[model samples]
Target: MSHPIHALYANLSARADRPALSDGDTVVTHGELIALVERAAADLAARGLGPRDRIGLCAANSWRHVVAYLAILRAGAVWTPLNPRNGPSLNGEFQRRAGLSLTLHDAASVGSLGSTARPLPLEAWLDGLADGVPPPIHDDPAAPFALKFTGGSTGVPKGVVQSQASGAAALASLSAFYDFTADDVNLAVAPLTHGSSHYILPVLAAGGAHVLLPTPDRAAILSELKSRVSVTFLPPTLIALLMAEADFAPADFPRLRHVTYSAAPMSPARIEQAIARFGPVLSTLYGQTEAPMTVTGLSPAEMTDPALRASVGRLFPGTPVAVLTASGVAGHGEGEVLVGGDLARTEYLDAPELTAASRHEGWLKTGDLGRLDKDGLLTLIGRSKDLIITGGYNVYPAEVEAALTAHPAVREACAFALPDEVWGERLEAAVAVDAPFADDAALKAFVRDAIGPVRTPKRLHLMPALPRNPVGKVVRGDVRDLLYPVDPQPLEALR
Candidate 1:
């Protein structure tokens, strides 16, 4: 079989001038996209970036950003797309750790990538795009394509090294599950630096158009969804925020075919509400940066059944997903989700100890606790790191958060455990809602009924909003830090 890049090149021959990428008034055709990539490849060569030399890209969502990514690949250099939101010091630190030779950045990141990356401003380089054709190199399927960084949702973000083979496998797995057509208009809501950016490749491969939304401007997203978007990916929080918008009528998104949501724990009740509004278009994806986004996906069709709608859906073809219990025994039921697959990363960049710790036997321990039913649909429990054990009872925060969000007013909820003198830890809930939770007592009662009294939060605090990483996964640690300030408040002042 031809490689994805080669296939993309082949597809360009048939639809040479078709819209490949666009941002506002600017639209680049497939022919233009290929020419830009080749020219940019020459620019990278002139700047001395080539095979085995790693580089970084720091830019927001733009067609130019996509061209830069493809150009890096075309030049046979490794590209790592870092979140441009990072400060210069932090970006420099990551660059040093990753040992990037160069970094291409837009105006927003040009200052942030100083000294560490032999920083190259994107505009200055684009102005000098070479007229000569790009020299071709043998395509190695096993060669590293891109180095992806995980959102520091847990802690310090780590870089995941992925090869072209794994990326192709991921694309193939998703294509089998989703239908991407030339007529589809893919909306780029997520930043190009993030994993969701990978969605653009399949669309391009399908001879479809990719529309970029640099920022998640709520109005712009709503307008795009209502008019042009056939496929788009939104994190759970963005989905919630858009749904909460006053003018957001589900019927407005008549053109939307697939709206994939993931990267965070979405409330089941909220998902059901979303499905009711947008029909079965809302898909829940379950994957980590380690897997590069295709472990399992809950399709709109499977979402029709209430029981299946709440699931993250079954594993990809030939992908082995096992839930290992505390004893490290794999089972079909509940435990840590261990996945052994081609898509999952086997090593962490510069962290051998961490890499060894994460993988068991041949399976990579996903750190996510989940269960698979007899039919193999996966239901996320909670992050094993965030699991709360209080009064000798195991409490998965996702369960409590789901219960709390089940309340009509609750928009988002996160539960954690605090140290206690008698009990090992006491359960605490921090909730974000449209309005203040009127009765903490009644809310606790609701949780108690849904889960047990042991899992109910002893203290419930209201937050205007919860902290989240760029990808929309709740930064549980940040929320915990905010909820419990230093020096501490008196017991009476709490809640």
Candidate 2:
């Protein structure tokens, strides 16, 4: 089978003059994109970088970044993305872990990369189209294609070893699930180093245009959706931000067909509000860094049902998914979510023990606690590690968060655990609100009524905003650290 990059090259060649990537002010045609990729690929080969060699890309989302990525693949080297939003120390650690030989970076990210990486200007890759093409390399399904690290929410990030087969499967699945067409234009609102990058291959393979927004600016995103965009991917946090924009409305997005959300679950209440604001374009998929976002999908049509809206969706066709309890698979109940398919990452690089522990029964243990209904629809409860046990009762943070977000005053909520002397672990929550809601006791009562006293958060605090990771996922750990500082608040203040 041909590599996904080779297939992408064929598609690019066929389209020629059709616009491939746009940065609002600039447009790169398919023909132009190929020429850039060919030149950059040839340059890499001349520099002695070849198959299996890791090349780091640290840059913001742009037409050039996309070209550089494609060129890295075309040259048969492994693509390793270093998110610009990450701290220098974190990126440095990732650089050392991945053992990247050379890093291609834009001006904005050059300072963030570690000194260990041989940083090259991304713009300088295409010195000129080479005299002859680089020597052809054989496609190997199991060869490393990309080196993406997991989001370090739980602990230290681990390098996920993604095979070429896994990357191809992700590309194919996204295209099949979304039904991308030539007319489809994908507005990349999220960072390309993250989830937004997954949509690029599918859109490109279908001969569609990719519009790059430098940042996830709500105003810029609104402008694009109002005009050229037909499809886009955003985290639920960002969707909430857009809704908060004074002018946000369904009528503004005439061309939008798919508004895909993932990274974190949006509360059912927020999802309903989104449906009203964005029309039926609100769709979502559930997957982690290990799986690369194609496990299961809920289409816009399926989202119309309020009950199904609570679910992440049914498993994607041909993808293996199960809910595993302590004993075995829970065919129609709640347990740890497991995935086994080509789309799942092969293993963690340089961490055999970690890899083995992460796998269960020949499947990748997703670390997500969820339920599989008789209908095959999966509803994620929370992360296994995030589950809080208070007074001998298990409390899913997501449940409490969902209830809090359902309140009109609350904009977004994050529930987490605090060590308690009485209860094994006490459930406490922080919320970002749209309106003044100083009555913490009343808010606690509201959540208690929604679920029950055991499941509801014992304490609720209003925050200006919740702590989020670079990709906009609310990090519960960070939220805890922020709320309870080293100095600690007085007991009276806590009450």
Candidate 3:
């Protein structure tokens, strides 16, 4: 069977004159893209990289990054794309973990990694491979193909191993769901290291044009929408910022057919605003790094429905989602969401215990506390680990945070459990405000009015900004540290 890369190459070969990828003025035609991939594959093969060998890719979203990714796959090696801003330490860490023999990176990143590990500059690598013959595809469908890392709420990044079959399955599902055609232009704004951003592969697979946007500039994105692009993927934070900007107009995106958001939950208000402005073009997907594209989704039409505003839509095709309870496994009424499908990653890199705990039988425990409504719509309550046990009562931080954010003055809020002598664990909130408050008393009073005394935060800390990972997930451990300082009175003896 031909590898996924071969399928992409076939499209390029058939449509040599058509645009395959673009980043500003740098446009690589389908023929050019294939040539680059082939040459890179040859160069990689010369370096002793063969089927199933791991190749680390550390670079931003650009033509070079795209070529490097395709080359790695064409050479039958697993592509391990790391965040360019993750720094050299992470590169070294991934190299060791993935057993990467070679790394392809941008010049600046190569300099940062130092002489101890001389990674090939992307430009030089491509130049050397430009004239080389295309290497025959040799990918094993069952072998691991990519290791994409996602940071948990705790801020520690874990690699999710995806086999070639799983990756192809996800792409096929996306292609079918979106009705992606060869003429469709998919934008790459999110970091390519992310599975969500890796939508480029599917877009290419469907013979669509992959528009590479290196920077996530709102104005540039708006301008691109005004141009030939039809599909774009953005995180909720970016969407929120775009809507708030006075320069952005609803008519700016005339050709935009679909706008998808992932990585974080979008506010209902924002979703409504997007629907009102963009005309039901908003799509929301809920998934984790362990199983990137498995969970539920909210379609464009559902965005306009008031009743379905809280739902993340239904499961994707070929995926099965079940709700589990203490009694055993139950039908999808209301329980912890568990997902099983070909798209699910079977293991975590170098973490067997975590893999065993996370993946039970065939289903992967999502760790997200969600319930399937009677309509079969998935409603995310909060993360299981983010659950706060206070004075024998269970409190979901997302619920409290959502309530707190509902306040007019509150811009954003995060709630976590903090140590307390009186209650064992007390609910604390860290809020980002639009304006300064008089004191904690005023803030507490405001929260009390919104959520009542039981849900009121024990203490509220005013923060200018929240520490988040590269993908925009809040670092809960850092937030906890900010909320609770190091110096504290010793807790009373348990006796």
What is the descending TM-score order? 2, 1, 3
2 or 3, greater by TM-score: 2
List residue ranges in candidate 1 displaced over 4 A: 1-4, 111-115, 248-250, 326-331, 469-471, 487-495
Top candidate by lDDT: 2
- State how far residue 22 of model 3 sits from its true place (Å): 1.2
lDDT of 3 at 250: 57
Which clashing pairs does model 2 show? none
The sequence of per-residue lDDT tens digits that candidate 2 reaches over residues 169-280 is: 8787788789998899999868888888888778877788999988878888888899989999988878988888855678888999899998777777788888889889
lDDT-better candidate, 1 vs 2: 2
What are the per-residue Cα lDDT tens digits for candidate 3 across 209-232? Answer: 888877788887777877888888
lDDT of 1 by residue, 180-270 (tens): 8788898987877876677767888888889998899988998888898888988777888887785555688888989888777566678
Measured by TM-score, how close is model 3 to the native structure? 0.91
lDDT comparing candidate 2 with the true structure: 0.83
State each model's CA lDDT, in order: 0.78, 0.83, 0.74
Write down the TM-score for model 1.
0.93
**Candidate 3's error at 13, in angstroms?**
5.9
